[model samples]
Target chain A: MTGHIYIIGMGPGYKEMMTDEAYQAMKNADVIVGYTVYIDLVKEHFPDKEFFTTPMRQEVERCKACYDFAKDGKIVAFICSGDAGVYGMAAPMYELLPEYESQNITADDITVIPGVTAAISGAAQLGAPINHDFCVISLSDLLTPWETIERRLIAAIQGDFAIAIYNPSSKKRHDYLEKACQIMLDAGTDKNRACGYVENIGREGTKTVVCTLEELKNAQVNMFTTVFVGNSKSEIIQGKLVTKRGYEI
Target chain B: MTGHIYIIGMGPGYKEMMTDEAYQAMKNADVIVGYTVYIDLVKEHFPDKEFFTTPMRQEVERCKACYDFAKDGKIVAFICSGDAGVYGMAAPMYELLPEYESQNITADDITVIPGVTAAISGAAQLGAPINHDFCVISLSDLLTPWETIERRLIAAIQGDFAIAIYNPSSKKRHDYLEKACQIMLDAGTDKNRACGYVENIGREGTKTVVCTLEELKNAQVNMFTTVFVGNSKSEIIQGKLVTKRGYEI
Candidate 1:
């Protein structure tokens, strides 16, 4: 017999934003494991379940904890913010599955419940900035190289796809957004191209801004901000950003 | 008094896939309106609510009807599959709001609740093919020009980012997916690159296929399919596709 693991995306730290599938998984799980921040998001709702958490930068250990709990025949819920598959813990968990199996402990059943990721949820606040083709790039360089992020930014701008920027700025990467905007501008993008960002999406102190590329370049932002550089067709209508489906409109 | 309008993304046509907010909006609305196919997906669950529908290619008429119902001070729910803001009725409805106000009937309150979109939802079925950066391009040239879509595909490939394609093929555009693969191949994409497609996502007769770019070029896909071409780091691990966050992994 094997234990079951549920890698669930909790969706922007709000219960209302989570899918019934994800909620049911949480209810079915006997144990929940996550980063402390994500676990605290759901601790109130599932007070009866055994909870385990790690602070940030402890992803490897977090995955190991979930496997250990699952190996003990507990229905383990490995939770993460946003869609579990997108920069969440699902891939890493799946990557480590073989390691656990080599110890004669198996978690043969793993279910991934998708949730509203930041790019899609943040776009809800700014109207429809991703109505057409769009790309999502992270400004954080912790896992990815800065050069790769820069090239992706240039490609997104050159492709004329509306770009959603995750982790736009952190304490160490305060100037990354400016560098990205410069790459876009260097690509001959119009300085007044429509742009916007949503800070702390679906959380307390949520804020939104709609401006041109020039304004976004100088805008104050933090790691929680989901920024967007709109396409050539993006516009500010009624103070909201919208990228229409067709130019004929 | 202006009535409220709730534009909700029903999320992959599954009750379990819908968000609590979308379900709540469905329960609170006096009536629900949508495309005929999408309405049928939720008709049984909320059989007591009044429902209105329009056939395909009648988006303008449908948006007008939602405004008309809202003007009558009814809690109108405008529902669509997947995230409402992404190629759904929200923008068009918002775009038409001013016109409805010209008739001296306004909907001053409209809440846009985001749900899981197909790209992210479909990714769950195929594992984590979007772990890092990704772009979504629809091959349907009905709304956007074909040349523009081709450029986006090339850019996504050149950027070395995973690409999720929406509306990959329709009755009139059955060859579009093939054309997209050819564009990638022409732009120096390896023929054996990891790629996948999910058919009828989160619905009956759901199917997932993981294969090389060469296989995808000739794969039989319909309108219901969501396709993807992986980045350089993408791989098939235990028959699951995953584009890892970092190459070192």
Candidate 2:
């Protein structure tokens, strides 16, 4: 019997925030595979299910194991923290799906389940910082070049779209977010542009700070943080970040 | 006794796609309020809960009614399709929240539950076309001017980001999607760029079509259709639209 591979992103790493569809997929799977950190988040809920994990930088191997398990007649649930379609395992998994065709595994044997991404979950935490047209860009220059990142940041600012930044900073790329802000400022964006950041989204110790574009440049953020920069119409109304939708009130 | 307002975006109007938190909020609400079309989608599931609905273009009055209900000590669930933070009621609700201060309602009295937005949901149906940095833009020129929309389209293309288009066309603006494609071409995007569109996402009669940027320009899509134009790294792998994550497999 050829089993199925279910690629699911359980939003913010919380059970409550997970969609019923994702939860059902989790329950239906014979085994779950994910990064070690994400696997730890769901361990308690599915204690008996076999779990296969890999650390950071082992995504290729992790996805391969998922296919191997599913090909061996075991239903597999491959998990990521946010929506897999956005900076998650969905694309990578699809990129590798072709190699397993001889084993009778086809695209039909795979299902990608979407979840609330950090931008949406973080936006809810910040009282809707992305209430208008927005762009989500990652500051991590791992696969994508720094030049491409710079161009996207500049274009987002020029479009006057609210921005959600992922992987804003790391140990080596600690100043990338700062550099991004400087580039936007040089592109004529306002220094006082409304911005906010949420750390540990949908988890314990989740923290949010709303600030101006100037303050965000100097703010210290880690990999767990999701950053938001509001559009020109955005404002901090009554202590909540919101962008008006042009409703005649 | 003061009550609370739960603002939730249940993606694609499907019960399964709703997060556990959103489902719980719906179960706990004393009454539910939304636009008539959206309210009809949930009415069958929560037959016992009171529902208040207004027609389209009455968003202002509809939100005001939610505040009135909440102020009158009834827990209210204000529903929208997809993530509320994305062009939904979250921003408008926060904008109107201040007017009820004398009634003792504050920001703390509201909770916005995020869901998988159409961009993410539609991307899943298309096999992960948005695997890289992406910008979400709406074609409707109701609130935003057409000139601004054109500029954003150009910027998105120039930045080389995959594009997820929302509200692509309406009866009044049927040619907006076509216009957007032309603008991207003028901005130096390839006419053969991989693009896909999904209609009635997560609902019955859901349909998806994969085409090029040129083909997308002539495709017939309505408000329910979410269009995705892949980035430069995107390709069709075994009949699936996928963007590579630069994995060395």
Task: Tell me, by lDDT, which candidate is best.
Answer: 2
Give the worst 10-residue stretch by lDDT in candidate 2 chain A: A240-249
User: In candidate 1, what are the lDDT values of residues A94-212, reduced to their tens digit?
Assistant: 67767866666533467788999999889888888888889999988998988999899889988999999999898988998998898899988999999999998988988999999
Q: Choose the strongest candidate by DockQ.
A: 2
Model 1 lDDT tens row, B159-226: 99999999988888889899999999999999999999999999999999999999999999999999
Which candidate has the highest TM-score of all? 2
Which regions in candidate 1 have their CA more than 4 angstroms from the true location?
A103-108, A247-249, B103-108, B247-249
- Per-prediction DockQ: 0.63, 0.82
Cα displacement (angstroms), candidate 2, residue A32, comes to 0.2
DockQ of 1: 0.63
Global lDDT of each model? 0.87, 0.90
**How far out, in Å, is residue B237 in model 1?**
0.4
TM-score, cand. 2 vs. native: 0.98
Per-model clash counts, in order, read 0, 0
